[model samples]
Target: MSDRIVESCRMCESSDLESVLDLGSTPPSDNFLTLEQLNKSETYYPLRLVCCKSCGLSQLSYVVDRETLFNPDYPYESGTSKFFRDHFEEMAASVTGKLNLAADDLAIDVGSNVGILTAAFQRNGVRSLGVEPVGRLAEKANMAGAETVHAFFDPDIGQKVRDSHGAASVITATNVFAHIDDLNAFVETIKILLKPTGVFVSESPYLLDLVQNLEYDTIYHEHLSYYSVAPMRSFFDRHGMEIIDVHPVDMHGGSLRTYVAFKGAHEVSESVGRYLANEKEQRLQDPEALKKFGAKAAAHKAELFEFLYELKREGKRIVGIGAPAKGNTFLNYCNIGPEILECLTEKAEAKVGLFAPGTHIPVLGDDFLENEQPDFGLLLSWNLKNEIMNNLSAFSAAGGKFIIPIPNIEII
Candidate 1:
């Protein structure tokens, strides 16, 4: 046991929680180290995914500090995945059109990783700004021509933005709402920052996908909570916001893109009711569902390890494809390293010369796939499996197989 630090639910702050699953001790999923740092005694913390019975919110008991998680040098560039950029472009067009955005409308995106979506809004002559705590990312967003504030979007910062920019017409946080530790303050800030009639959109990995697909790897330090429609609906109601719509997005494997505004700003969309009904039918609010899902996740872990070990026994060399944050979680949780995987390949130059966070597996450029073709390549960014398979055709032409773990362990 890694000396228990204070653990409480972000939603209810109820210390009365039950452990749904324990991934054991692991390093921060995104803490990719330089070669020198790799040699040091890497720090590992206990990673336990717990649930608040009072609030029905799933979270990690061990929380890493914001500064350590959101470093100035944090290297997750959303634009690296062309699929992600194109997906956001489509979303920007749809949301802007649906909200009847004008050229002068100001939109703010919280934790705008590299400002890819903000730039999409800019292309339409709309004034857009991004609030990012990571200096390098915020600066990059500014250089890309989207005004970005290099600070965390807390209630204080939200008030400042509201005072200066005058309530945002559209405020969005994509794949970041779940990481917020202070859910109450965060939602309160959203209420303070948006106009009375403005729309606030948030997208996060849906708990349904996490459970059904056994995507336990997505449970990491930065992500403090896994949200569902039931709990979030109750949460937003408490904060005086109504979920106007919920769009199911295919991005991030499966995600829920929720749109909200001041209570009674617009009639709640039928989509919200449908999703909530679906949650109830699926028993999403029950703790037993999560516990069952945890068992399924453990079975998945065992199956993946067995399949890889069998391949190794048959003298088949294995290499990894796409070094993503979740890839780190999967690799570290599954205890995969050089023994199971020869090297992890990545497209991003920032991580190309680095190593996997805790496993210390060497990350190399995609050139290795062509020069040293392995028998099978474990698709780490399996969420973007189709795009990766298209990009690495040469590897396949040389008789290579791509292994996708989530949903199920399979060779595709």
Candidate 2:
């Protein structure tokens, strides 16, 4: 239950950090509570963002204990969403073809949750392994036929993995890259696990998109860094690695997929330069711009809360659509609870019977939408609104509307 305030930038170790956005304190986003645990006290940590003046990297101002944040019973399962499953499948196929990986070449997925990407790699005819920290998830991945090692990824684990299965041809850290607090150590681990010619690909929510789209809800304890091409290129270059390519992917609102290789191991793509130029054009690193973003987020929060209150006054019943971890941040920040959201519907069996971390909104199966027929559904997982809305078409057909509260407050 220990946490500490970060006084220096994680990427460049710069003490010249500027506070950008402060969302106050929040309980761990994934700490879904059991009925018995609801009555007990819950811990809350500071949820604030700061930008480094030296490297232009955006990161959290506080560091929550890794053990507390990612307990053995971590509830998120990447395979639970069909959208993510399909995305990972596409990622594996694309990386395999681009790298000309053969069946003999090994692919390792770092922080592979339930081995979704690892399984996708195996399906692509390459031998794949998953490195996951949570024992429960590792066991689940093994049961699903995706061999996984249950240990936190570091130089030691990387050496053992390389010794057992040979250096990896491709290593991926999709959405998990930003969760790392120690960027330097992580890169060292990547170097140890990868062959000289191997490529390390990381996909994370781009800081540019987060600021432009007012995606403040995505700021949580687990996501330490909000990566952009400029800072990422600088960081990799310092480690004697180069970003060979960069691509924007449509996942988790918006994400940047970066391909890294040992210096001169691969040809640099024009996309990297384009992304860097775009980031500069948008003033992604300007401290003033980030402060403005914080102001915009505060304004949006007010507007959304007012709108929801108005709807409630009109006697409309509202329930949350998807109980994603980011949704917990929004719920707690906006102070929306079971009073406003009757319940939250989720597809993950693990979360269905539990309650949201801070808001304590009951999580029920998606079937609850059809059975309860609430008047309006607050789309907590707004990134997957299309998929969820399409899946819950029956709810819409029954004259129910949806409220999308991110970027803007809209009823669709």
Candidate 3:
């Protein structure tokens, strides 16, 4: 009955924290279970956001433990989206060229899901290694011929990597940087692993973009910290590193691809200065902006539930589309259970055979939408609305409505 122990900000260890938003209590997104497991009492954990006054880092303080986040049979395959794979390839080429990497140089990827970008490095004859915490994903990366380490990346592991691979010429984390609970430890690891001339590159959904785009669904327990150029620069500077270059990539809605290097080893690019200026001008660090974002998200939840409830009252069959991780946050936040939606549809066979995390909504194959002919489909993965709608042209032709909730509420 007591409150769970709270985690301190990895950067500042400031207990001076306040909740920005509480998506109520919810189960971890990746804890999809068997039907028998479903019969047992389900457990829920708090999905709360907190802002650190000292460090200016927005984070979730509860640690759900890594086992819940990265299961052996984690169903999300990075290769499922060709669009993401292509982006990884292009990114590898661009960064390699920019860093002027030699054929013999080594590249290390932390949490390299399926080794997509690492494979790109291997193609150019650069020795590549991937460190993945999840057993299944690490196994997949190893099978793909990338030297895979089946463990989490931290200061110790970073040292081991440097000992073996002779200091990575380049280190990268794609959509994986935000999951670490220990920002100081993570940066220390990156510093120890990099060669004197090595660059640490990361791509993460920008906090600015998240607020501007109303991407409240991106708030999951796993993503403990959100990043922007401002906080990141300060975080790295403490460890004798410099933000050298930055490029905004269009993956995962909108993301910032950042490059950093050892202190005084590389020229701090003008882009870093420009980005900091922009952040100051826009007041991204202002606490009021974040407070406003929390309000906007609540309004979105209210609008979405009102519309869906009206549909249910009309005796219309409503089904959800794509059981994405973000969808779990939205569903739990809005209290949308099977009563509101019969079930959800997913393209992946693994997810289709399982149930949604918190709501326990039975996840069915895409055929469910095609055959059963739902009156309205709530596009849970609104980020991929264009792709899902295009693929479900048959449903649209059959007079089905698609409801997308985020940025703008629209029915197509």
Each prediction's RMSD to truth: 2.0, 1.0, 2.2
The candidate 3 region of ten consecutive residues with least summed lDDT is 1-10
Q: In lDDT terms, how accurate is model 3?
A: 0.83
Pull out the clashing pairs in model 3.
none
**TM-score computed on alpha carbons, candidate 2:** 0.99
lDDT of 3 by residue, 1-412 (tens): 1234465665667777767777787887767777878888777887877777766677776867766678686777777766777888898888888888887899998898788988998886688899988888888888988778988887888888888878889999998888887677788898888889999999988888888888888888778787778878887888888899997888776899999998899887899989889877876766666888889899989998998999999999999998888889889899899999999998877787788877889999999988999999999888778878999999999999998888878888
TM-score of each: 0.96, 0.99, 0.95
Better-scoring candidate (lDDT), 1 or 3: 1
TM-score of 1: 0.96
| Best of the two (1, 2) by TM-score | 2
Write the candidate numbers in order of decreasing lDDT.
2, 1, 3
Please give the lDDT score at residue 183 for candidate 2: 81
> What lDDT would each prediction earn against the true structure?
0.86, 0.92, 0.83
Give per-residue CA lDDT, model 1, range 110-137, as digits (tens).
9997899899988866788899999998
Off by over 4 Å in 1: 1-6
Question: In terms of TM-score, which candidate is stronger, 2 or 3?
Answer: 2
Candidate 2 lDDT trough over 10 residues, lowest sum:
1-10
Predicted candidate 3, C-alpha RMSD: 2.2
Q: Give candidate 3's error at residue 103 in angstroms.
A: 1.4
Clashes of each: 0, 0, 0
What lDDT is obtained when candidate 2 is compared to the true structure?
Answer: 0.92
